[model samples]
Target: MSRLITIDNGGTLTDVCVIDGQQVAYTKTLTTPHDLSRCLFDGLERVSHEVGDARSLPALLRTTDYIRYSTTQGTNALVQRVGPRLGLLVDDPRILEDLAREEETADLYAALVGSRSAVLDLGVDDETLEGELVTVCNRLAAEGASRFVISVGGPDGAVAERRIRDLLLAIFPRQLLGAVPLLFSNELIGGDDDVRRTWSSLLNAFLHPAMERFLFNAESRLREHRTRNPLLVFRNDGASSRVAKSAAIKTYSSGPRGGVEGTRALARHYGLDEVLMVDVGGTTTDLAMVRDGAVDIDWFGTVAGVTTSLPLARITSHGIGGSSVFHVTDGVLGVGPRSVGAAPGPACFGLGGTQATITDVLLLTGVLDSSTYLGGTFRLDVDRSAAAVRATIADPLGIDLPEALTRMQDTYAARMAEVLRTEAGPATTIAAFGGAGPMSICAAARRAGVPNVVIPRSAAVFSAFGIGFSDIGQTYRTAAGDRPDDAAVTAAIEELLAHAERDMFAENIAIADCELTWAVVDAAGATTPLGGRDDAARALKAGGRVQLQVVAVLPHPRLEDPVAISHTAFESSGTRAVADATGTRSEVPVVDLARQEHGAEGHGPLVVEGPFFTMFVPDGWTVAVSGSGDLLLTDIPGSSKEND
Candidate 1:
């Protein structure tokens, strides 16, 4: 059987999903922040065992046809403002003066230039410019700036940037000892927006070293196993590229990019045109919108409240999740922007944690089965959950245990509902996933005014599954002048395609295995697909300035067959007592989804257990098991099916 392995290295946990032909297996383990590779290998071992392979790490790696990896390390690094110290080299002195005139821009400029940076008035004589450049580089290096970003402002920005790069190369050659790395703004982004381009280049430079270290380390391990396929890393641009070709900034929130892809696939399967994807992870809750069967793409993504011109999926992430810390300040309960993380985890994990978290609240509210959590591999501490709730919430508000848990969940659900309502329209369908999604999805959807909700069987490791469904691809774009002739537009497109071809060739993807497509964006921000070179040229000749984007889709081993539900039944495991959102206790039938046959149907007030997730199907809803092991939940009383 051919095997495909994909791993998502999240903040609180590392999820591993393996697809071996028609069979699938998944496992989750705590993220080892000190060394992510440890958790990666650990989860791999567990997944291998679940597949009944029992092979060694290198042995399993050798047999795996392709491995796709995604991580949240860069996202976390940006959030925490932790990375290599950087220095900025600006060609124009007026740009710094302009930035300093405004408070907001001044703060952003400070962040971009960092504490150790130098500005050069390169318009001066070449002798003076060269002397200043050397002095600035030496001073910044002395001040501990290991990474440098060179951005030149004004009309001659590109020419000046290249000149600065060349000068730096001469001073610090690749073989030179202790040579610092420098990034040129024009090389990463071709747009004329100097500020945005500078920020993009700076972000990329900051994230490069750490991402390179971890990914290369992982790739080396795979190479030692004699794997033939190069490791592919998922990018936020909805494509996968080899480690050498990928930019670190492109990988931010890439795990959720997978979820968006999975959402698109599911939308196609169900024939739905619009859906809202809600991915709840341990550290954050990410939300994205899909309309008219297309996922939204933000060509200029906002990172850390700063706008960057990076082609990324439009995803809004809130600091609320299973591991989000819960606190009562001034007798007011508040959910978190702070997380307890995987080290201590939530109070229920019994790992010496004392802080109350959303996970602890879920356990106290009966949504999570203490004994069957993580497939019963690790047991949760009920006493700890109750105590944490009492200490952090109940005692502060002079409320009881149940009331405290109820308030916390209500607050969190209300917040999530508000985010959804603000970001999505009433006609959109809600698809929720992640380890903590199902427990809170029903309440959040109800509060947000959404009626339909669908939870896939692989909800816990949904992002990793999305990684499995990715295509190896890359996108390139170049500016096309206004009212250009067909020949000009055609030449621009060919140039972008040529760049993509060169990149793919370096990645070992042949031209025959690739498909090329093009789109042209007019001056007013309207995009039209190019039918052919003539069509593109004609449109450009007729219209205003345009931007040509070319995408090259390359071949990769993917999971093409429909996932099948196992025939095993859950009657032997029996039922269990669980509580609904209303705080009413009821004995619900506990069904092991792995044992359920295809086309099985059930009603609410039941517990549907999958490999790594637990779903609390409430009353007034009907659940159907698809042939592909997906849990389709539909509202029975107030549901309305809308056409695309």
Candidate 2:
């Protein structure tokens, strides 16, 4: 049987999902930031055992059809601002010369370039310019700036940019040892907006070195395993591309994009068009909207408040997750923008962590079972969790342990509710997933006034599952002027299509099997499909100016769908004391979903345990197991339930 594998390298965990024809296996391992490949291979080895394959990289690689990977490392780097020091080389010295003359403008320019960046002026003198370029490169190198961005202004910037690129190549000579990497603005972005182009180049240059190190290392490991199919990397554009063709800027928040794609698939299965997708991972919670059965794409995406021209799936990310640090600040409790990552993890993990986190709160409150966490692979320490909470939150506030726990849950639910209220429209269904999604979803949904919540069986590694579902695709775009003639528009579109075709050919995708589609965005921001018709170009003149986008999609081979789950009977494993919103403890039924049959229905005050996650059903809620093994949670009528 042909098999497909996907791995999502998250902030706190490396999730692996393997699909072998009709069977599927999922697992997670602690992410090793010091060396991510270690955790990646570790997770793969464990998953291979579940699929009944030899526990060796080469064996699994030879048997699997393809592997797709997604990661949040780029987003983390941008948010933390902890990348290589950068240097800016501007082709036009006039701009810098003018800014230097004005103190206020110079300060503003410095702020824009950041404190760690060194900006240099490239004058018109060819001899002096080459010398100046080398001198500045050495100077920036001395100051610890190993990566450089060369941006040129004016209409002829591309030509001047190429000259600077050639000069840098001659000086640095990439073949030489300790050679620094240089990025050019015109190659990454096509536009007259000098500011946007410069920012894009700077961001790309900052993220390039680390991304290259990890991705290329991972690729080399795969090659050692005799993997023939290319290792596809997920992009923020909701598609997968070869590692060589991917840009680091396009990979920001790419892990969350996979969740968005899975949400779309779920929407299709359930026949719901409008839904609110919430993905609660260890480090962040990502929210997005699917209206009319389609996910929205941000044509002009933004990273760290800086505008970029890369097309990305529109997802709202908040610093709330399972590993979010919880602290009492000035007698006020707050959840995080800070996380106790995989090294120490949550206090409940008992790996030398002292910080109280959301995970600790969940364990202390009995939302997670100590013995059954990660299906008994990783045991949790409830006592450690309680002690951390007592020290960090309870004692600081002079409140009892139960009250402090309740307060933590309340604050977390309130924050999630606020985000939902701000981002989601009224009367939207919520589809929640991720390792932490099921635990907090009920409370967050009730607070957000969402009536229905669906947590799929593959919720823990849902993002990795989504990566397996994505198509191999690439998009090319070019800027067009106002009222351009048909010939100009035609030529531009042809150029983009040709580029896409060439890229696809390199990836071994044939022209006939691939699908080509085109769209034009006018100056007024209205997009009209070209539909392979040249007549559509006439509409561009009416809208002022336009830009053409051409896309080529090569869909992955379809595998067998998930095996249907049969409902035989409902069996309770045991009873556990779970705390409620009021901090009162009561015996709650713990049901094993694997033992339950299709159409199995149950009441609330219970824990529906799965291999990867656990769902807490409150007193007034009801749940049913679908034929596909999906757990559906709903509120019962005439029953009052307090938010947890």
Candidate 3:
């Protein structure tokens, strides 16, 4: 019944959302990538100030019942290739052969494990095997393996991996200085697939150190303030648990997953069947689908080209957003996979950045208001944006400033549209959120042939809002095998539930008070909810192929019914000069949502400026305000889509 705090820690910005009774307040802080905890508390302090009663950090934390956090640290690590180098030991060389066949896997294998791999002769005696294992492992350590993975490819390969792990531990004791930690594939997943299990282990080992360092540091600092609840980490599996109970690999892309969770809830509320989520932030544009008001879980998800036996949400990330660098090399224009991140941000931020990003170009083209942007707490530098654009874009392309800006706008829209088209379907509606999502979504949607776009009033920090009411829970799963034996299935359920109970106990949740939902997932990713365990087990006995998944949740505070839809509309407050592609300027209506009522509707050539973002509705698109204060823009068929 206490207040809740939810955070989405992104590469460029960290969002904080605080919910109390019927009121919600949120704020954003530039992420301190050098020290993540800095931005965390910075955001907390800023949002705390935004609260009416809770005007300080201590007061906010003292009254906070739950603190849920999701971060992009693991995703950035993989994309930046910054992690511990791993040494792999496999009994069969065919495992590596099978993995190296795929081009992506080969490149990933080369980057993470590389030549620091060894194949052992399992036929040897214990003494011979121990000697070889010690020698090979030590050699790998010499070759720069801060961590080691042991995997054996067979039905009883897990047992084999354990045997090798024991032998290696004795040779290289953990207490010794610089003794690399050993991780086994069986410990990370329950699957029988050798390659997936190995990759899963490898990914976890690579991400574990960085996650552990920052999360623990953040939690310890909060504890110093005598905070009430322990910090909870929101996982990619749509559940949250304490940092100690979390896996590093599961934290991958967790920030974006928060956005998808929000999008799914919005879709269900609107009764939208198929919706595309475009969560554009300063660092990346994360894309996902909410089909039938539910986001599909990828039982066998692929992370950065390496297939892992992890149940991940079906989402993809493209490195394009507000501060994404522009490339005009060889007269070919392109956006980014590389971002300016939080420190330097865009050149318009007056942070000494040389890169020209979408943010700068949009400002130059008259869509974003420099003075009133970002709540007007800090005014953007128009001169800097123009200079950066001219130097990086116009000079390189040998074109005038106006022509370069137009080209940048057109190219970014085309690329964004192309990305959306890849996930296109009939009746597909677009839900755009985040700081930069609404900026180009109308154009992108029109170009991609998507009919309508929805922008939440809380779009700027919607991800943090989505995770605001997340319950503290963890999922326990185990492979039940092809043929479901009632006894076997029951035993698996009991074991997994027992494990879940143990984990929940640490969070001060009683198993009896927690809700337990059961389901069975097959190798091919078909899931069936269990009505009654025994009856369903009997029914599935013939069909056989299934694994038991049980989730234990301790329900947390949630918002009651939100504001109902309103049919009210308001007129634009004023007009601003906006530019077209051909360098012609025209006056555009400006609607300030803060000073006006919700449910305001109008046609294109108008700017809706909020505290955190600026959205432009071009000609051909009709914008309406829903009762819930969200912007619903429907594209008129045969309207000008390219000039938006």
TM-score of each: 0.87, 0.85, 0.87
Instruction: Judge candidate 2 against the unseen true structure and give its global Cα lDDT, from 0 to 1.
Output: 0.74
lDDT of 1 by residue, 1-644 (tens): 56889889987788898887546788888899889889988998887777674777677778887888999898888776678888888866665565445576567556555567667887786667778888888898898888888888654465687777767666565675246877888667753466777778888988887689989998898787788688889888777878998988988888899888877777776667788888987778888888777888776777666667675678888888878988888878888879887768899999988999877877777767798898898899999999988988899899888778778878888777777786765567888898778766766776676767878778888888877767777765455444555566676557666777788798787755776565566432345677755665565566532344333443332323343334333342467766554555667788788887666677766778887788777676666667567777766655432111
> What would the TM-score be for candidate 2 when compared with the true structure?
0.85
Q: Which consecutive 10 residues in model 2 have the weakest lDDT in total? A: 554-563
Summarize candidate 2's per-residue lDDT along 398-454 as a digit string, tens digits. Answer: 999999999999898887787777666546878889888888777777777776777
lDDT of each: 0.75, 0.74, 0.80
Judging by lDDT, tell me the better candidate of 2 and 3: 3
Clashes of each: 3, 3, 2
Candidate 3 clash pair list: 565-627, 566-627
Collision count of model 2: 3
In candidate 2, stretches whose alpha carbon ends up further than 4 angstroms from where it belongs are 53-55, 76-148, 152-182, 325-334, 337-339, 393-399, 480-490, 523-527, 533-569
**How do these models rank on lDDT, best leading?**
3, 1, 2
| Superior by lDDT: candidate 1 or candidate 3 | 3
Superposed by TM-score, candidate 3 places the C-alpha of residue 30 at a distance from the truth, in angstroms, of: 2.5
Look at candidate 2 and tell me the lDDT of residue 79: 67
Candidate 2 residue 619 Cα shift, in angstroms, is 2.2
